[model samples]
Target: MEFRDLNISESIMERLDEKGFTEATQIQEKAIPIVLDTELDVVGQAQTGTGKTLAFGIPIIQKIQEKIEENGRKNKKAVKAIILTPTRELALQVHDEIDSVNKGNKLRLCTVYGGQSIEKQINKLRNGVDIVIGTPGRVIDHLGRRTLKLNEIDFLVLDEADEMLNLGFIDDVEEIMSKCKEDCRKLLFSATLPKSIMELVELHMGEYETIRVKSKALTTELTEQIYYEVKEHDKFELLRRIIDKEPGFYGLVFCKTKADVDQLMRRLNDENYSSEALHGDMNQKQRELALSRFKSHKIDIMIATDVAARGIDINELTHVINYDIPQNPEAYVHRIGRTGRAGNKGTAITFVEPREFRRFKYIMKISKSDAKKEKIPDVTEIVELTKTNIIGKLKQLIQTENSEDSEDLENYEFENLEIVDELIELADSKVIIDKLISQLFKEELNRKSYGRIGDYGSRKGNDGRDSRRDGRNDRDRRDGRRNDRDRNDRNDRNDRDRRDNRRRNNDGGSRLFVALGSMDNMDTRRLLRKVLEKSDVSKDNISEVNVYRNFSFISADEKTAKQIVDSFRSERRNGKPLIEYAKR
Candidate 1:
């Protein structure tokens, strides 16, 4: 139903029209009328990104508008509504949405969150605001400072209640609620109704009505779910292959921790993939910058942890990759929900190691998603796909040119008709077209393959410098004795080259041992990517990457090596420091 049909103010309808929001989402349709028409509390249960903000936001704004119309505008300066969110990002998002609806400045709105100056928030509150949106901690701080008053607040909203509980803010939330007037109408929105949330509702709300928007078995029907059972060592290669195979691939790769997010982002950039990392370690400005780049398509991939990815609203995302399986099943749903939005087709792929297979299965069972198993596409398959895409584009061009509505083509004059006729006389145009296509395909394939296989390919035993040089020399040899002598010399040189290469690959530079390796789904490419992306060391300055099951060793120039070790000395993955210099 349209927002205009609801029993809301005309000003709201005008603002909604300006924002291009004609119809209401499911949650909005069900909850708005109840909030506007009655005094009862509400519990809205729905998945994230289903427009819960507007569901509660519209009613809160409308109530404030009504109070202003009923009472004099002079008396409406007090804070009448308060929205509590799980994080500062969410508070900011909700504040923005509400501000959009309050276009006429009829109701003053302000957001309070940690990290910004508390004094600034105090100044805004003292100036007077009709609605206050904030995190629990910051709101409590304001209450403690006596800078915020809730006795006059008539509307209360607890958004992402489950997330707030998970972050251990339930005590603060209850304390804030206790500060509010007993008659204030409370609206709680959560993805899941956990036991703690239920108890909070029982204690806080009075005769509240539950509004649940049932989703499809999968969080999104537009997303095609799939998984690949890959070994830890091969994941980076597979990731690269998948990226190479898909031409407009913009994806979000979800890792399990801040360390994984940092490591994976570095690796992707090292391999020339346009990517950025988002995790708790980044400050607010850095986080905003990374998110802005992703939204503007300045970067094609976003490597993020679950907590850091919250309140991120990007509608044109193409894919979501589970680089590491989430411990919580609902997290998987939340991660993939970022894509397949606004009726666009999207894809979600998960990489599951053998050890994590059971955990993955449990997640699938709980999420009620039947993600299909798929094999990683090999290089030949990717080449064929590219060829097919090119051919399809050519066929489309031909069809468009030959269509009856080709006014542009009719206006054009062919100055080379004689040459075209000669070409047609020599061979049917179909044969010539096929030959040209074959040549173009070969060239395209070669162009795409360059630099894809990194420098490690040259380090193979049979593919090294000595064997190639000796093979060329053998082809030029004539006499058997001379050829034999040359062969012996070449063999000796080959042996020395092999030994030297091995030494360089093993211990040519200062070494540092990292605590995460194959067991954590890490390999040489990932290790190098992590070190280089997070440190000042260039890829060429680094050599000798050896990965073990639980730990790994890397070597770089002495100065760069010390820098890397020092940089990561206090850096952590899963709450532990990342690297230490190896003992001799």
Candidate 2:
């Protein structure tokens, strides 16, 4: 439905036009008219792209004017509306959207969230604001401090209500609601209405209108959703490799925090990838500049946080990489929503460590995301991806005949080959094209790229380099002592053999000493077999398997021996008996 169909104020319609919004989404089409009709409660259930913001925002903005008219400036301390969001990033995002649609109009707006100083927010509140968009925690803090007087508030909006519950802010939300005037209008918007949220609707919202939109909570039909299980220490390097391998991937890499986004952006730039970052800290112009670079095909990738990407409405976004899986399932839908837009196919790649997969799977189940486990791209795949991207770019440049640069390209082509002989020149040009394509990728190669094979960061916590060095030194000392003892024993044996005029022979195989005991209730045989399978050790290489009541022992090659010992010591895998190398 068109925006004209809604009975909103003329000013709001002008602002919507300015923002390039003509048709209203399903939620907006229904919720707007309902909200505008009465100052009653509303419960909107829709996915991220369904435009729930304007549905609630327009009504709240309209109600503020009515409130100001009814109460007058004499009692301006009373805010007309309050929007409670799940995160500071989301609060800021909602505020921006409201601000954009309500520009060139007389409406005061302030956003309060954590991370930023409360002093500034309190000062803004003191200056007198009509609307507040805030996180539950900060909003509660303000309500307790009596800095934000919601007693006179006419409207209340809970954006992404399910997320507020997931973040454990429901109690805080209830507390804030208690502070609001009992007669205030309430609107609860969420991707999926959970039972708790439904209970909230029943208790708090009175005679609410329910609007539901038909769309997959998470649709992977047109997109491929995959994740790589990497250790925390290795994520950065692994992400670096993925970026290098995925060619022409116009995508957004999502990080949990703004700090992470900034650091990853810096690292990507250092690795020579044309990437930029978007975050809350950036000013309006900076945000616009970064987005403009992305939209114009100047920037290949955009690294952003979920909050920073809230106001982003870029088309041609093909991939959404979740560098960190969201704690809230609703956020997972929103992040992936940036892609698979306008009927275009998209890919969402998440980096899930082993422990995180449990939570990841839970999100998938709730969001109904058709995410599948995928093999991480090897180095060869990355190289091939890079080559393919470069070749595509070159082919496009050749096909698109530019009047100004056509002669230059044509002359260069002639100089490089025998154009006088048609077939030979064609064949030569093809060969040169292939050679140049390889060279292009070679130039763009990330020299710092390395697949981190089982990181040691967890073991070297507290003190980074010092701990690693100390561990290595202690291992070296232990090995050195064992070697010395072996030398002395062999020397004595040789002397004995020489004296007896007989050949020396040895029959005992390599021994593996385990640290686990009967006290731990470990099944020795099962543990031994699992160890061999996990390490991919050959059965022939494994000699005598000795099972002790306390600690079991296995015999294997020196390489397999060290791997088994390290795997047990790492404590990463579950269901494994905690057994370290007692002796070898």
Candidate 3:
């Protein structure tokens, strides 16, 4: 259905057409008429990328404009509508998309979120806005400051209410709603209708109309789904290898937590891969810069957590890799929906650990999506593909003899044409050509240039698929291997036995005691990573890390040591302080 069919005015229809929104989606086609004609509250259930913003945005703008014309410019800057989102990214996205539809009108809009100056936001609010798009926390802050008055708002929208519930913002949402006009027409939109969402509807939208539309991406037909069963330790190796296998891979990779995103992004950048991290910890400027780089193709891969990835719409994404499989099938569907958008073909790849195979199967069954087992390609195979793909992209560039390509590539190889002819005559023709080609792609053509990926033939069964077992059993095996490694390094343990002498001498370094050890999930690598992340310490400046059953110690420069000590006052993991210096 088209916007014109929904009784939208010619002016608004012209704006929609200019933005290429010719056809109305299921929710838009159904909900637009109700909002434009009726006074009942609405609850719209649709997929993430299913044009939910426009569904409510169009009617809101039209209704506001109609009110303005009917009332004769009396409430020019009076707040009439408020749209609340779960995150800052989603807030900005809604504001931008709706602003496009509200263009050429006298309507005013402002977006408020944390990580920006509150004073600036206050100034914007005082300037008399018609519509406001913001996150819950910021909206509550504005209300407390007495800068934003919602009592005059005629419409209130809770976008992504399920996400708001997951983020523990439902309480805040209720508080904001309580402060709104009692008779305001409320609209609730979410991808899912959890019990909490229904509770919200019962409390606020007593007489609401509902619209639920199932999008085709839920089945994932346009995406080729594949999974490789690998151990947790070998997942990074497989990830790197798969990345090398596809030369044109440009997409997002999902991690389960922010720390995982940071660690994986660090490893990828260390290996010279174009990548960046997006998570809740990053400031708004940093997140915007990372997103800008990803969209402009300056980086080929973006590592993000699920919460941080909400409201991102990149229609040309080629792939979506699940580095950590989501816990539920709905979350899985949401992650894979990033690709196969705008009718483009895409691929969804997942790495299932030994213990996750059954859970993954359950997800597949619940979502009714088909996934095939794929093996990690060999290094030699990746090298061959790299050469072939690179040649395919640059073949026309090297065709110097062709004079038909717009001034012949605009003089790309024109200067080298005479030299090529001279060189061909100076040596055997085929020998010269082969030597030139090999030298041209020296790094890409070399098998050793690609790093080593582990061999897992022993882990595969007779059927050429992974031999699955409990991850706890695999951990036991790894523990046994660690014990052997410790036994082999007894000489290093003997060095630690001379602890008193080193503590007194200090070896021109400071030895600090850590409050955690093996029992608290402490280890040399993990402790080092935590310390370096919290402070300005260089890895080379630290040494002599020793972990015991209940405590640990490490040596670093006095500056790094003091920074680490000060950082722990606020730094924590899983709500527990990670480090504390000895009382001396």
Candidate 2 TM-score to native: 0.61
Distance (Å) between predicted and true CA of 105, model 3?
A: 1.5
Structural similarity to truth (TM-score) of each candidate? 0.52, 0.61, 0.53
Each candidate: what lDDT? Answer: 0.76, 0.71, 0.76
Residues 168-287 of candidate 3 have per-residue lDDT tens digits of 677779999999999999999887788889988998775889999984546557888998877675787688788888878998999987899998897777556899999989998999
Model 3 misplacement above 4 A: 72-77, 214-219, 226-243, 247-346, 349-381, 384-438, 445-584
What's model 1's lDDT at 488?
A: 52
Pairs of colliding residues, candidate 3: none
Off by over 4 Å in 2: 69-71, 215-220, 229-235, 247-250, 254-265, 276-299, 303-318, 324-345, 352-366, 375-584
What is the alpha-carbon lDDT for the whole of candidate 1?
0.76
lDDT of 1 by residue, 159-220 (tens): 98886776567788999999999999999998789899999999989989999989656578
- For every candidate in turn, the CA RMSD to the true structure comes to 19.8, 19.5, 15.6
Model 3 weakest lDDT span, ten residues long = 474-483
Model 2 RMSD vs true structure:
19.5
